[model samples]
Target: MTPSTTHAQHPVGSGFTPASTVDDVLEGIDLTGKNVIITGGHSGLGLVATRALAKAGARVTIGSRDTDRAEQAVSGIGDVEVRQLDLLQPDSIDAFVARYLDSGRPLHILINNAGFPGLGGIVRDARGYEAQFAANHLGHFQLTLGLYPALRAAGGARVVTTTSGAQRVSDILWDDPHFTTGRYDPGLAYPQSKTANVLFTVELDRRWAADGIRAYAPHPGIVPATAFNRSVGEEAQRAMGLIDASGEPVIDPDRGKKTPEQGAATIVFAATSPLLADIGGVYLNNSDISPLDEDPRPVDLTDPDTEVPVDVVPHSIDPRSARRLWELSERLIKSPSA
Candidate 1:
C-alpha cells in the first residue's frame, strides 16, 4: 500500500488518553526481535520508554553523553545497552552511528529523544550554531541520516523525535536560527529547535516513507520530574503549578502536566502503534495525532491557569518550510567546521 500524502493533523481516536501510561500503549503489542535505539534512553521519559519497550521484547540501546551514568541508570533493565553519544559533538554522533551500523542490525526503531532545554544562557557548539538547535535538531538529523542503511534494511522502521508543545510558540528563526544577530534568549531558541524537530519529521517522512521508514514528532507534555523542569528550581516550578507549595508534583495530564510514564505514552505510541501504519509526517500528543490549531496565544509560563496549546501549527508542518529547513540543515552539517 502506498503511504498517504496528506498531512492530516487530527486525532485518529487512538483509544489512549493523556493519562495513558507506557504500558497502556504497549498493551497487546509484541516487539520481540525488534532492534531499537533511543537517545537519552537512560533518563526521564526516555528511561521510562526504554523500560517499556524492552519489556515488550525489543533489544534496546541507549545513546547518552555519559555512558557510565546511563549504564547505572539502566542497570536493572533487561535487553538494554548504553553507548556514548554527546549530541553536541559531531564526531560523537558519527561514532555512535558507526558502531550501531557495524553490528549489522536492522534498526526497527530510532527515537531521537535527547534534547537540550536551553536553560543556561546562549551556548554554541563547535560549529558556532546555537547549542539547542545543534544538539536537539541537527545532531539528531545527522544521526538519522547516518543510520539510513540500517533503517532501510529493516524493511519497516519508525523514527520518533521528541518534540514539545513549545513548537507552537515559535517557528524557525530562518534569518538567524543560530541567534548570530540578535541577543540569544533560551526561551526563543529552545522553541525554535523544537519547531525544527517537527519540520524535520515532516520532511523525513515525505522523503523516506517509500523506503518503509516513517517519522514522527511527539510532544510528551509537561513532565515536571524531567531534569529540564527540575533545573528550573522549586520556586519557579511552584509558580508554574508544576508543583505545590509543599514541593509535590501536580499530575494534571489534561493541561499537559504529567508523570514520566504518562509523558512517554505518546512517544511509545508513535513508535509502535499499528493505527499509524499508513500515517506519516504528523505531530502527536496525548497518545494520538494532534489536530491543527493555528490560534495565536501568549505563552506565559508564569500563569498556571493558562493552558498551553499542544496542537500542530501550520508553520511547523508547512511543506515548503520543512523542505527549506532540510536544505538549510544539509548545508549546516556540511560546513567546513561542521
Candidate 2:
C-alpha cells in the first residue's frame, strides 16, 4: 500500500489547535495505567511530552543514551524513569529492550523521538553508516524492530516517529544508504533521514495496523536550542538567522522558535487523542491534515509534507510505493515483517 498524502485526519472537533500545548491536547484524556516510552525524553520537546503524559497518570519511561543526561532531563518531571538506550548502538537497544520486557510491562506508546542533526563533516557510525542516517533513521529502525514483540503485546499501542519538514528533500539513496559513493551534503543527508522516518511510519503502519498497532510521523515543528543543534554549529545557526549579532541564541533554551509546549502538541495528540483512531500511516503537522503542492518554490515556506518533496509528494502516498518501501526497508533493516 502507498502512504497517504492526506494529513493525519481526525474529527472536526477534536479539541486540538495549532497552538495547543501537550497538556492541552491531552486535556480530559486520561492515560492512567498506561506505559509510554519516549526517546530523547530527557530534553526539549520530548521532555515536555514526558511531562504531559506523566501528569495524565501514565508511567512514562525515557530512553536516553546518556543516563545522567536523561536523569537530568526528567529531574522535575513527576514519576519519570530513565533507561540507557542509544539508537546508534545496536547492543544498547537490545539490552534495554530485554530489560524492559523482563519487567513484564506491556509498552503502550513508543515515541521514536530521539534524533541527531547533521554534522557537516562526513561522519560514520561504528558500522560505517552515515551519522545522520544511522542515528536518525537506521537506529530507530533497529529499535522498533527489536521491540516489535513488546509493541504487539501491548495491542492497540501506537508508535509515533519524529519526522521533519526536511524529509521532503530526498528519498533513501537505496544504492548508497551509507553515503559512501556521493558527496555528503548535510542539507540533503538530513532530509533523507527525515524522509526515511516518514517512510518508516508509513510502512510500519501498513504492516502492523491490522494487529491493532499503528504508526505515525509528526513534524514537531522547528525546535531550536536542543541537543539536536549540537551538531549544527554556531556558524550554521547564525547562517540560518537563528542567532543575534551578540552571538547569543535569539531564543531561550527552554523556548524554541516555538514553545516546547506547543512543539509537543502533535505528538501528544497522536498518542492519546481519540480523533486519530481511524488515521494512521500519515504525516501530520499542527494538528491538521496538511495539503501538499508539487511546485513549491525556494523559501515557499510550505507545510511539512510539502517541504521535503524528494520521495513523498502531495500524491506520493499511494498503495504501491508504501508497500514497496515497506518491503525494501524491512530487507535493509533485516526486520522480520517490518
Candidate 3:
C-alpha cells in the first residue's frame, strides 16, 4: 500500500467476530516460542489478553506503575511476570526499556494497552505535557521507539495499540499540546490521545515496513464495565446508558457495549491472526477492519458538546497528521536533563 493509501476497516475473513472470546480467537493457534509484553496486563481487557497469550505458550510480561497492585490482582495466575513501568516518568520509562534490552530477549509482540480514562482535568507530566497525551500517547511513543532493537531482532514483530472509537472526537492540539488555552476536559484529552495512537501506528508502519515491524490500533469497544470506567463514576455512567441506576450494567447490543472477553477478542485477533500478516497500520473493531468515518458524528452527551468516537476519524489516520505527530512525539519524549 502507498503512504497515501488510507485503508478502510474491511474484514479479512478471519473467521472471528466481535462476540468472539479470547479462547475462541486463539483456538488451533500456537504461540509456544513467542514473547510478548503488555502494559497494564493485570486488569480489564489487558488481563484477559495476557492470560490468553500465556495459555497459548507465549512468555508474557506485564508492566505496571504499581507492581504490587498488579501482583496482587494476578496472585493466582501462574507464569506471568510483572515489572515497574511508570509511563508518566521519563526515568522510569528509560529504566524499563534498558532492563528489557539488557535481557537480550527478542520481543515479538508489544501491546500498549495501559491508558487512563478521560474524565479528569488536565494533569501535566514532568515536561508539562498533558497527562492523557503524555501517558497514553507520548509514553507509548517513547517505549516503542526505545524497543526498536528488540522488535527488529524478532524480524516480524507486531505492536498493537488499544485505541478507542473516541479517535474521531478531537485532533492533536499541535500549538498547545499541554492545553495551554486552559480549557481542559476528559472528553477532549482522551480522544486526542486515542487519535495519536492510530496516527502513530500509521507512521510507524510506513517507516518500518521493510524492517518487518507492523502496527495496529484497535478499539476494544464500549465495554459495559472495567476499572477504567471509574473515571466517570456511577451517575455519569447511568446517564451515558452504560449502566442502570441500580448499579447493574446495561447490556446494549446496538451501542456496542461488550463484556471484557468480547472486547478483548479484537486485540488478540489483531495480534495473532495470520490474515493480518500482510496488513498493517489499519484501525479495527469487531475483530475485523472498521470502515473509515469520512464524516464524523459527534455524540452530544453533555452541554459543552463532547464528541464521542463512533469510528476512526479521517484526521486521526491521515498520513500528514501521522507524520507530523511522529516528528512532534520524537521531540516531546526527550528528557530535559539529557
lDDT of each: 0.92, 0.73, 0.84
- Judged by lDDT against the true structure, how good is candidate 1? 0.92
User: TM per model?
Assistant: 0.96, 0.85, 0.93
lDDT by residue (1-338, candidate 3, tens digit) is: 33225464566777776577788888988988898999999999999999889888888889999999899887766468898998999889889999999999999999999997746566787887788898999899999999999999998999999999878778887777677776876778888899999999989999997999999998888887888874588887777777877888765534577788888888998899888899998888878777776766646667422434566767877888899999888877865321
lDDT of 2 by residue, 203-317 (tens): 7888899878888787776655555753477877666545666666554322224467877888888788787787788777765444454454464433322332222354334
Measured on C-alpha atoms, candidate 2 has an lDDT of: 0.73
Candidate whose lDDT is highest: 1
Q: Relative to the unseen true structure, what is the C-alpha lDDT of residue 295 in candidate 2, on a scale of 0 to 100?
A: 53
Q: For all candidates, what are the clash counts?
A: 0, 8, 2
lDDT per residue as tens, model 1, 1-338? 11133567879998898899999999999999999999999999999999999999999999999999999999989799999999989999999999999999999999999988777688889889999999999999999999999999999999999999888878899888998889987778999999999999999999999999999999999999888888889988888888988888999998899999999999999999999999999999999999887565667766668887788887889898999999999989889343
The model with the greater TM-score, 2 or 3, is: 3
Mark the regions of model 1 whose C-alpha exceeds 4 Å error after superposition.
Answer: 1-6, 299-303, 336-338
